[model samples]
Target: MKNKILVLGATGNIGRPLVENLLARGEQVKAASRSGQDVLGAEGVVFDYFKPESFEQAFEDVNRAYIMLAAGYVQAKDLLIPLIEFAASRNIKVVLQTAFGVDADDAIPYRQVELALIQSGTPYVILRPNWFADNFHTFWKAGIDHGQLAIPAGDGKSSFIDVRDIAESAAAALRTEQFDGQAFNLTGPEAFSYAEAAQLLTEVIGKPISYNAIDDDTFIDMLTSAGVPADYAVFLSSIFYPVRQGWTSVITDDVATLTGKPPRSLKTYAQDHRQQLANS
Candidate 1:
């Protein structure tokens, strides 16, 4: 239990790598997921937001924790506040991963959770990451298989960040107290609209994948037809309103500032993940 760090959502895109980054830096790491299944190089523990009992076990012997909500659930405030409070009670430093633009309004659930953390008078660093470039492989892979990407995002660009940059940022936050009580908006090096992103994918994966700017109703219907939960699909569709309104196209140096290297561009993300993007 030597200066251990508990990483909730450890099996996820950012968590897994954040665990790796910390272990590489010689930190004792606890990787927490729903299953409590062991990661290769770190101890694993069970953690679920709805299960308050799991919090004590997950925080056991850990001096710091990275807090985040898994995808799908929208009641972020209800799910996150308890965990934040538990960590605060233990005086565990928190590095929270909430979405970009949440701080734009205090009414936002994630922002509210953030406020709770800051007001708790605990050491904390908030990392607000923009859209993930990995979504091309995870969320839109089926559309790529079908040669199209249908989303409600109109002619708008997003500075989609690589999840690796996010993990590194979190690791940086958890490794030191210098940035405590501060927040960083993490984004990639540049912005690209869905159409432009699709073209980059077409070149990287060697396929003609097109972008279809459908309406919100059509987007929701598409996600629902794809077996996504109806409520969650609507939630996903609502986020695109920011994209269409030109809010997500922001670029920031926070990634480089956090990790001491520049954030990867979309083209680089496509090139690195071409195999996943190419697969059906």
Candidate 2:
């Protein structure tokens, strides 16, 4: 029987591609978002993480779910627990998109949500993906366009997985029960510092872009000045402090193991998005 998968946040960076992949594989997809938005021709359902009432409708008749909690949300744990419990009651599997370094005892909100899912007794696969390479186009696009990538991650390297790779892995996990109860730490094939990434961008986009390692306060100020929410800007800057301390420098092959191919390299990403970088 073909699996019926519900992809929450289906319009997001990862969810959008995952939805397309699943549809290509002939799976039945219910694409759920806050506004009931549909991607391509998939079924659309309204879902709000802060509103528990919206979940039941979204989960109805679904055999599996791809879950991604939005950033800057305070009710992740509360929202996820009930959703997990309800899914478990209905015998549905869950593939949860989580962050690297989130464990059962960690104080981070994602960690708490993971704990809730585990304790709910639902069949689950946890994807602990590192920072995304697409952030160059999304989060850091302005800086890259302006020829300087400024961040608080001073001299730190990260294995930034491409968002498409993350989505492919999610689709793979959702399609098969083989990876249940396992947590995979997904990363790109190589680690690159911000400076190194800037160099790659320079080569691909034919411009001299540079990395500017600023203090956390300065980084936060830059983001806010660019009109990012102050709280979200601070939260984002706080994560980089760990990177500065060398927490995110490790590369992994889990992406290859899961997707049957090596993860995309930073250089490849830079080349693929050269137009955006060039025009920046």
Candidate 3:
């Protein structure tokens, strides 16, 4: 068997496109999810963060792997470190997906996982992506359908990146050693406040969508009331601190630098997913 690239979270927003891109370029791919469901053009394997028995089979004969923590798992290090260690033992290069602004800080859960990767003495590249523009169609679609998007981002802006760019960058890192031992802060072409994003979406989808900037407590309460776990809701609201503080309003050329093309804008993303935005 040829050495395949193992992509964890294969059914996720970033993994799906990453698998597609790699297969298009003639690279072998093993798409791993909890269900072991196959990507359209790739082999499928069962891999779950809470289930360690699945790791060996998933890593078998794989030369490189893309690692990402699935949603609702706050203990990123616990889930990620074992995979990193196993990959290191097998000499498999890793391309890890972490949120933007998480660094080698011991306090931040994701950063602690990052520190382990760096200290493992293995070949690795990290892609820290900004808030995803895709969330408009996925996580926040119900609100969009109601003509209102509510979050606690306040008047601050975020250079919300399209997940496609993140996948492209991950593919590049996995295919080459040029960016090994480095981390890229992937972002879109520009920053936009929630209100501004709403305006752009309104224009593209031909509807009046508004952004409601609520308080953190209110946001957490709303999420919990909607069936989101209280701890996870708190986690979600906590991350928005950077956005409200204007820290996330950063734009970078990292996506262009890695993919050799400009990242997609909010307008373009909304236009491409207009059907979902219009109807969802």
Candidate 4:
């Protein structure tokens, strides 16, 4: 009913906090999810990438949009580009959350979406975040509960960032036109190999957590066995090639640049989420 910030994946790890950050700043928000579930103090609406009709109401009267793909959907370009074009047609500002390192190749689906946004003749900011520290309590939580994180990362290191910093950065981007048309690669202050990360987790949790370097096939098998779709499992395994190649180890000041505070270290993430790590 008011000029609002439309936040997709409104109930997600990043979206929830981003919505809160906007609300804290006294901005109106329209929080959207597939279920149209209510978010804290924000107008709730149903929005789905698979449903184009939902876009109109979600975009109605909204001056800015925080666009990020929901989990488990792999066709990033096909799903996001059209929505981006629609927003561009409406002259709505866009802050897109894409993956780090996608810029190295134009063939990358996320990169294609970025290119589309850049050429869309609309105000846009791209946020390319590195690996998330919350994965310990999420995607890999099962493995941590089992005391071993089995992946194909081998000895490579990644500067894993907390989702909170990402949310803060997105809120910052959406609130201002200063960063329009610029892309920032968000990352943590330090990088750690899976082995080093496991050691850190073990120290923080006082429990023995180990990192096992398996081949991609084995990693895919583990995910498929865990009920992940075989295609998605394989897709997940393919992305690990960058981790194994040491490409994900880069650190950046973008988070500090955007949020005016340093990104949280992995140790801080572990210590703060120790309880969740062990049980959630």
- In order, the Cα lDDT scores of the candidates are 0.92, 0.86, 0.92, 0.94
| TM-score, one value per model | 0.98, 0.95, 0.98, 0.98
Candidate 3: list runs displaced more than 4 Å.
Answer: none
- Candidate 1, 13-58: lDDT as tens digits: 8999888899899998999998998875799999889899988889
Candidate 4: stretches off by over 4 Å: none
Task: Name the candidate, 1 or 2, with the larger lDDT value.
Answer: 1
The parts of candidate 2 lying over 4 Å away from their true place are: 72-75
Task: Count clashing residue pairs in model 3.
Answer: 0
Q: Show where candidate 1 strays beyond 4 Å.
A: none
Deviation (Å) of 140 in candidate 2: 0.2
Per-prediction backbone clash count: 0, 0, 0, 0
Candidate 3 lDDT over 1-280, as tens digits, reads 6479999999999999999999998999999999898997699999988889999999988999999998777888888999899998888899999999987356898888888899888899999999999999988998899999999999999999999999999999999889999999999999999999999999999999999999999999999998999999999999998999998998998998888899998888988999988985
Residue 223, model 1: lDDT of 86
Clashing pairs in 2: none
Alpha-carbon deviation at 35 in model 1, angstroms: 0.7
